[model samples]
Target: MQLKELSGQSGVSAASIKYYLREGLLPAGETVHATRAQYSAKHVERLELIQALRRIVGLNIEQIRGLLKMADDGAPRLTVLAAVQRVVLHLDTAAASGDRPTPAADAVVRLRNWPDYPSDARNALNVHLELMESLHIPVTRELLDTYSKAMDDVAGLDIAVTTAPDSVDQLILTAAVGMHMHSQLLLKLLALAQASHAIRRYEEDA
Candidate 1:
């Protein structure tokens, strides 16, 4: 496909595509002539993934480049997925900002036995603790234990689906894009369940 066709098919502007090509975010299309170039299905797929990472996952060009490199280099899927998650979920910034994990966070990690798991999970828990502190919300160990139980329940499905993808690239995309999307869906369902419970409890009083 030509640049115009690629742009149309990918739903990204030709100008942006050219910019990505120049920035090394997208691979260069095959040059057919001095000016003309041809793109393939791979380009289209790559563009779609790039767009998702940019618009949906909110990854900057550098992070996307790293993600693409990790995908192409056949790095360990779990590590690559963790790197992608850190970028997409802003975990790296959170981990960097905090000097150390809060005692509450560390206790939760020990209670949950996540020390053997990937660092991403532990880091995210620390970020949550930081948020609680910043908001002046006192979280009890008991409450954290309850939350951990719920998180573990959700994480079981999250890990299962995220690891099911056959390719490293797909897993990265899934962890970055798909998992957050699914998280939102689950939150919405939880909200609906809460609403239903509230209505059931309050309906008799009304």
Candidate 2:
């Protein structure tokens, strides 16, 4: 495909594609002639991913470049995942090394017995646990176990999409952006469920 075809297929403007090329975000196509270059489906995929990262994930060009660079350099998926979690979007992935993990957080880890839980995620969960504790809300092992079971399914969905991705960059960015968008949907579902349960309980009590 030509550049114009790529732009049309990608739904990105030719000017913008040129800008991405200039910024080294999109690799140049094969030079088929003095004035023509050939592109392929890979270019389309990159452009779409780039657009998603920019418009959906809200990552700036430099961060996207860095993330893409790690993949291009043949970094492993875990390394890319860590970089995205820690350095890319600042979306729930920041934690200091010396910070303490709450008891509930540690318990959740022990129940799972899983190594490689991201520290920032544990810290994020700790914040919720502490808040509930302060509010005199009980967080029991049974509750955590149930929630953990539910999230295991969610994790499966999360991982399943990125499992066969073409590259580490594709996998991480796809997961990151998809998680960002679906997180809102998940919260909305939770709220609706809570509202329905509250209504049901109130009617029963009445």
Candidate 3:
């Protein structure tokens, strides 16, 4: 497919596609002539991914660039997916807020030292905290703790599944589908497990 064909199929303007090509978000197409280039299905898929990351996921160009680099380098799709998930979640929540919120000094301090959280993740979290504050949602220490614990539990399970050698593809597929289709159930199951463990601990203490 030519640039115009790709543009037509992707719903992205030809100029924007060229811009993405220049920015290294999309791979260079095959040089057919001095002025003509031919794109393939891979290019089309990548362009759609870029568009989705930008327009739907609300990632800035630089952030999308980082993600594209990671994807191109054959980094585990889980890592990219996790980062994208965090960004999309924050974007959706923030979009619902009419006003920006201020981050608590303590929350900022805690977030600053959070290990393995890239700058983009921190930015997204900051935006989410601000949105919560604007909505009068308390940025209490307990709230942060709860969020951290929930993420930790999910990440632990995800890591376990992804590391399993025998069914890696199946695991990734399950995660991709389950995270979208059964997210509520997954959350509920985690909450139930936590509640059960808490009850057991209380009973033992009593």
Candidate 4:
């Protein structure tokens, strides 16, 4: 199809498509003649990914470009996936700082019998623990375990949806979009559950 058809199919304007072509966010199509290019289904797919990153995940142009590069880089699968996860999580590139939450967080992770998490993952937990401590909130093992069990269910769903896809870019895009949107799913689920339970427990007074 031509650029006009591509734009119509993808619901993107022609000028924005041209801008993406120039920005390296979208790859150029096959040159059919001196002034015309022929796009294919792949181009439409790429445009959908680009629009989701922008409209759904709220990633800017540079982040989307970088994410595309990371997904397409010929690194080993696990390495590329780790890179994508870090990008989606917005974790720092540097190694963990080994701050106050490391040991306790490490203990909880070990107790959960999960793999030895990377320092960055541990540190994300640690930072929150530190904040809770500063606010005098009790960080109990039972609470940690409860939250871990709930998140294990979520992580299982993440793997089910993101890992089975053959396209690495699709995997990355699914993870990015799912994590951003489904967090709200969890939040709203909690709110609804609480409301239902509270309604059930309400006692009518005489």
Best by TM-score: 4
Candidates, ranked, lDDT = 1, 2, 4, 3
Tens digit per residue, CA lDDT, model 1, 1-206: 99999999989999999999998878898999999999998888888888888888777889899889888877887678788777766677665545455788777778788654537656676777888889999998889899888888888888888888785656776788866687688799989999999999999999
Q: How displaced is residue 192 in candidate 3, in Å?
A: 21
Q: What are the candidates' C-alpha RMSDs? A: 3.1, 3.1, 9.8, 2.9
Candidate 2 lDDT: 0.78
Superior candidate under lDDT, 1 versus 3: 1
Which residue ranges in model 1 land beyond 4 Å of their true spot? 95-99, 117-121, 130-138, 200-206
Count of clashing residue pairs in every prediction: 0, 0, 0, 0
lDDT of 3 at 33: 96
Candidate 4 deviant stretches above 4 angstroms: 92-101, 196-206
Determine the backbone clash count of candidate 4. Answer: 0
* Tens digit per residue, CA lDDT, model 3, 74-186: 66765756655554444334343323323553464465444643444445566667766679987787767776767667767765754454332333333433444345677
Each prediction's Cα lDDT score? Answer: 0.81, 0.78, 0.64, 0.78
Candidate 4 lDDT by residue in tens digits, 111-187: 77888756555666777677677799988888888888888889888878877778766776787788777877889
TM-score of predicted structure 4 = 0.85
Best by lDDT: 1
On the 0 to 100 scale, the lDDT of residue 140 in model 4 is 82
